[model samples]
Target: MIASPDDVLDALDPEQRQVAEAVDGAVCVLAGAGTGKTRAITHRIAYGVLTGAMQPTQTLAVTFTARAAGEMRGRLRDLGVPGVQARTFHAAALRQLHYFWPKVFAGPPPQLVETKIALVRDAVQHCRLRADRTELRDITSEIEWSKATQTAPDDYPRALLEAGRKPPREAAEIAHVYAAYEKIKSGQGRMDFEDVLLLTIGLLDDRPEVREAVQAQYRHFTVDEYQDVNPLQQRLLDLWADRARSLCVVGDASQTIYSFTGATPAYLLGFRRRHPGARLVELVRDYRSTPQVVGLANRLLAHATGEAAKHRLELISQRGEGPDPRFVEHSDEQAEAESTAKQIRKLIDDGVRPAEIAVLFRTNSQSESYEQALADQSVAYLLKGAERFFERPEVRQAMGFLRAHAISSGSDPEPAHLPAEVRAVLGNTGWSAEPPAGSGQAREKWESVAALLRLAEEFAVKWPDATLRDFTVELAERANAQHAPTVEGVTLASLHAAKGLEWDAVFLVGLNEGMMPIAYADTAAKIEEERRLLYVGVTRAREHLTLSWALSRTPGGRGRNPSRFLDGLRGTGSARPDAFRSPGAGRGPDGTVRPRRKVGPVRCRVCAKALQDAAERKIGRCLDCPSDVDAYLFEQLHQWRLERATEHSQPAFVIFTDATLTAIAEVRPLNERQLAAIPGVSRTKLERFGDDVLALCAGHELAIESDPDEFEGVPEPEIVPDGA
Candidate 1:
């Protein structure tokens, strides 16, 4: 019996139904957060198969992450469309290679080799090169990220080189390592994981007959998170797109954060360019978050620097509200963490699930303080999206030993424990970095790898008859090895890991000046990236988004100020937390963050110097001079400024403006540079007797920190790209 069209329609919301039934041609389901774009795509696949519009084997659904691919497949299976190969690009490539390998390689494909850190150490020792442990560790990490992103050595830019990343030592060096590593493996006849995709793509491209045969097998396609297509992956997608009009895609351009790994949003943004007459559908209602959350997201994008946010279609939320968002300011880091812990504990007591909450921060390093706090509270929580499964010390070691046994044998060792697929991947990156001799720390280094082996051995003893599959399987068990507590609690994760995920409660911690938008956000492009991150953080909360900040790192120093993004939401009289605020702050009119007002200069009483530039300098006393202080020299003024900064834990230049310091050193300005020489004295200042500096000095000239070039007014945020 055929599933009725009405049944399919009933399966989807009205907005989702439009995408599901858009089967006549190319369709772009440009879904924003929380929209049922994934649902619509699933129903579309089910509809196509059930209605006899397409066969199960004829369709493909692709996603950014393997986890997402698994979710999509499960959804399809739930819909009774079991044959649809919803897959990650890599997985899809491997499938193709499995079928086409014989045609391209002329024999059973050579097993790919996995290289471990021990081997690198072996190579280093054999090469007699003296390397520091940190240097060795960084080299391994660099090679891993490079190979993951598929960046070749010659292609690495100058900046990367300066960052201390060297590629393979020599061109032939890595090739030799890889080739020898493979030779040893081929003798054992086992395949590496990446070899699957690399070999598969190689197969389809080399043999036309095989490529066509495989292409004919799957004719329709759907891709989720279409924006993150990398270079090599795009080529495989292009092959399928050639004869398929059943392709459907959904993604958001604003969350294009993986640009570092060669992921590009060009595919999503320029979809129409690829299929000129394609149908485009956008779902604006955000079913994933509360209206207040949605409101904040909208405003954040509205204020964000780039066209991505400024021109985005606002995501309206249908989720219900729960709590008034709070922006707490603490005195220091410990207080920030402790306060957040209190919120988490309270939420759990109120019956919120532990997994339902997330504590997001800017960087992984920031997780330490929160982890400590959570431990202190005896909270059981998981770090979001970490390689909790694969990269754990024990898990990697188990996989390492098995892969090593396979490698040492030079062919398929026919290991019973590892899954056939994982064994394929075991060829590349299976070891630890070795410590150099006499340089010290070799034992420590070897012990770490040994501990990993010990964990693996423990697993093997426990599961005597286990397969390679069991090794990867035990990862989650290993993660929960301590089984610390059974209570549901809060989650701790990075803002980057929180995308496409939702939490009932979210505490966005560390919203301080240097931590949120971050200090490096001086350039226009960087500022926009920071804004996008804030948008991501705000959208992750389904109910409450507690905007927070700390005043300082020291235990009781004046707290570091809130991020500028908090413009009005800190104390009372700011933008009120309301449905009207953009999805980020979603502050009500009253809660809107009022931008901070500038405090102009105060002339120095003893030296007649004005104060420092607000951002780059500090407020300091005049007589705390450096022993080398030359009141007449501007460079000497800088020295004095540094001396003061060292004493006060503030940056240099707080004592005086660079221009003022330069003027002082150049003219030894015992007096103003001919009245105009009063550094930073402008037309207004001059008209107002700016040269009164000498009078304020009482007798001697001291440097001031105020900005000399600040003009008549604060500029308004631009409303549009004038030309565009």
Candidate 2:
């Protein structure tokens, strides 16, 4: 804690001090990663309070996450300013709604539904819709995006079209489900997280007295992570600061990567435009990472295009030089996981704490192999953004049964006997010696129990004479601490979860094309966002950084290329700094070193014009170009797809969307090779439905697929109940 209010200025950098001292007007701070944005903002708020420029009780600081709000509150308290209100948008809105509901008309505020998945399921049933787990999650995500963007159910289809979005299901279906979900919620007198903000906005907008009361209470407002603000949140913020007496927003446009959830940098980027007299501050001094890591991060942004790129901050490292970021290429995912675990083991052996290291990937499914590999190396790890290992149902059951057995034994066991005893106890809780076949809930459950078993093995190795009771006691202490060893373990998280976090050594694995940019990021904006995602990942490393990709998902599969983002940054003869290069960079798929070629814009097949639209490029022609598609063939394929969907108990689009069918009809492919050229014809789908699709195209009877296991199920979107 600072000794006095004046001392706050002493802790800030020149630019940060500028932000802190300018407490009188609308301030827009373009804070880069690791630039002490939080530190600067907190000091500004505290200084405003201690110096008597603003009342702490009247000032409100709103952030996107509860964790961020807590951190802000903690900082403000440490600075000797504690009366300020710091909360998430939902939390703040909920409090206001609860307070004003009785005054407005209601007996009490409606019950808050934390998870919308259950309600969504009910709505799906009401709509007579069918969706699997993945589809449900996708639907839930889409609905969340819709609400965040303030798109109504009736306007959802148009919004999807306008946004150029490829929804999991048809837009009409989703809109129907959304409408049904809302009706159900209203009937139950319940509100979702989005409704919390929506209802609050309604109260403020429609009721002038209520609006005046809120505006009077919170005269000064500070918003953190302004780049991630959506339309709904921005609207609520506007209501809170109706007059804009004093508002300070801090964010980086380059870090605005949550567009899928409807988060945009528009608010932050246009802040000055909204307030012409606003004081703009750019904080580029990065204190978290070393010069080398910072350099790589800047290089990534250098290649980025679009509006976000125009405002991209070139971060300057305050720290001294560190290890150059390493780029590793592996033969397969298994080998990549093993090699990564080996590297992490070496780092741990070399004295880096497990908690200081993180292995981040593009998705959650990528974590399983790494989990197994890390366990093989006896390395402690924790999955971020996932259920706590000890809190898992299987783990809790295992722990309970283990405690019972320990109480009944009434005898001490040698350290070597501990692992076996723990495994036996876990076995009673349906834990198997071998893991399940696939990566699903069953596998996740097994991993949790398996992690416990691994912990026991390590514990025994450390304590030679420990008993089962001692083990349980240690486990209890660890669980209470919220970590395996004093809440310390290597973090395994997705790239999205690793934001706002820094690690001493970061391993960014699975940088393959489809995973990094993601196969679904077909549009220019989405691709640019993917680039920003990598930029965020690169900036997360404080010192050692390893960026790696695997050629194949499994051994002996077709080799794949590294992420396009790494094209100029990896391999020999690359344009990256010499310090960051390995011996053999820019290797082709055949393992031969090749000169890099600049990929030109994709030109249309019919006309030699550069194609811009993703859909146009996908089919190798402009939308306005003449089509060579066989109309009869297209209809036949469509009918066959519909029949196949019914036979498989799946949606028609699951087999192949209309776009893919059209592309196929246009190409009139005679062989599997040509069919594989189509965009949505996944290798798995090709193998399962390829023969049938080809048969239909060739004017032959469709082959019946008898084996259900051979079905490559493509999930259609549906809502996952909130909190599930």
Candidate 3:
């Protein structure tokens, strides 16, 4: 049955209704996470079609992901408005490009480049520049960054320098490779993903007829996640509208965490500037998380500083009270992981389904320990963004080959020759000692197969009586279980993948300083993005939220500190119950009160000067006043120096002497211009580490001012580099 317009309007709350009913001209809906932004936009399309203000075929609903687009289409279908076009920006643009290619370009469009990294590797070889994996990753990142910023290859170096970004390799080298990459791609009659949007925009802008046709066909446009729209996307959006202002965009600036991808909230933040008469609506009511969770999210954002932070919408929680967020500290990463798995088990025992519990971490690498811990406890768990061990294609294929071999043999193979048998099986199945040329996926698949062989070797050693048949049976059972979609298991996911997802109980693991903000998040903007990511994780809890960290990776190692983000949450006005106490509450067997672990700013080991930079604190000394240098900071500087050495493929200390870092730390220059004045701080170093050095010093200073008592007993050291 076709639902009436009233039926569509009735589904939304007051704020959403206001947005859904606004069917004309430019409308911008600032929808927060879990605010039913999807419902608002879907309902808006339905209302438009029902009210004769928009035809389903004339409206284009653009989303960022295919999953989101499918959901939008499904919701529109449910609303009796199935014909509305809902697709990703790429999908929409690709469709138009495909349709108009022969007419506009007078030939078939170039094939889309599916494997960019391979092409980039070729570009590097063509440019005669040697690059390692890290450098290659960074160069590709630079290319993406350049494309996202709408900077052409010829202009990349200037734009990169102006932005004060330190490329992993020489800017000129990267630029040369970028230009070569473009040339090679063009020569091969191919286009990368970014070229789709760029080409579509160019076609629309240069050809009036094409623009008019598109504008005429899609007269009304609705964009989801507008805050993440890059400049290229924004230009395409503008061209699609053809200056008619029949565009509605929905996004939450606070959720704008894709800056790394060249997505800026600038477009969303400046929407009103472009359309002064645009109707604005804010969806602040959050229906996903509990009030406690909502309060925590609000507190987290209260510390954010950016354009997105400036326009932050405080979410009004729609649900009743739930458990206060918990903070737990552990002795090390292993203890943290084991304890987390235990907590999941406890939550499951307490009536919460295993599927309703999640263990979220900052990075994908952090999942390994947790997976092991869960497996040790025999807890069934799914790694959300990772392929299951038994489900990997390589693993499955190897298992199939093993099973067939075992069946053909009609007997158990001797454990002594199992290693050879496994190798022979893999070799027969086209496995190679070296990765195939220009195919990363093939290399990864080979690695997966190699891993399975290693597992088999280990299994053979662990169980001397085991046969190939035994291993095959075990593998079959595991694969079947792992491949089941609805298996009852806890979820382990990275924070990035946890966005737009919620759970009844969430354990946010690995909240340590270097892990949370990450060692590489060295700038204010990067830090803010990290904060937003944490906020997204915090808001994913419906009933319970547990924030946790560990002191170190192992026992008796240098202690890792909790994230600075925790300080903001602790200082917030919100009141909540604590489930765990900070470490160092009691003494050893002597029954004495343990000396309180120094909980304050780091002091330079040399002069005992308080060091604010967490890295500096870790190093335990200042650069010049090496009496008490922050060892970690020194190590980090050394590592960065080594990376620079590798970029030139030269020896370390040749790029920049240790004394140079000392001078930099002593001078504590606040910017590249200032840093360049110091001796040994060469033009290359200035270009490479200038922004990083300044950020480090600034972070330390801020930390000191925020909590001076932590620096008690430490004398204030003068900031003066040797030459300065």
lDDT of 2 at 668: 64
| Model 2 ranges off by over 4 Å | 387-487, 571-724
Candidate 1 displacement at residue 2 in angstroms: 10
The true-versus-predicted C-alpha distance at residue 557 of model 1, in Å, is 4.4
C-alpha RMSD values across all candidates: 23.5, 24.3, 22.7
Error of 1 at 494 (Å): 1.8
Best by lDDT: 2
Q: Tens digit of lDDT per residue, candidate 2, span 1-724?
A: 6757679898888999999888887999999999999999999998888788889978999998899999999999899898999999999999999999899996898899988889889889999988755456667877888999999999999998898777777889989999999999999999999999999999999999999999888888999999999999999998898775689999999998788778889999999898889999999999999988888888888888999999999999999888778888775665677778878878988999999999998766567567655644546688998755466666777788988988888454333388898888888766789864322345456656776775676555434345677678656644543432324668999888999999999999999997788766778998998899888899899999999887665443467888999866764221232222212223567855433222244455567576544466456578999877666678989988889766544446556767778877776665677676565564446655789887775542121134434323412112211111
Q: What is the TM-score of each candidate against the true structure?
A: 0.61, 0.68, 0.68
- Full-model lDDT, candidate 3: 0.74
lDDT of each: 0.58, 0.78, 0.74
Error of 2 at 97 (Å): 0.7
Q: Is candidate 1 or candidate 3 better by lDDT?
A: 3
Worst 10 residues of 2 by lDDT: 715-724
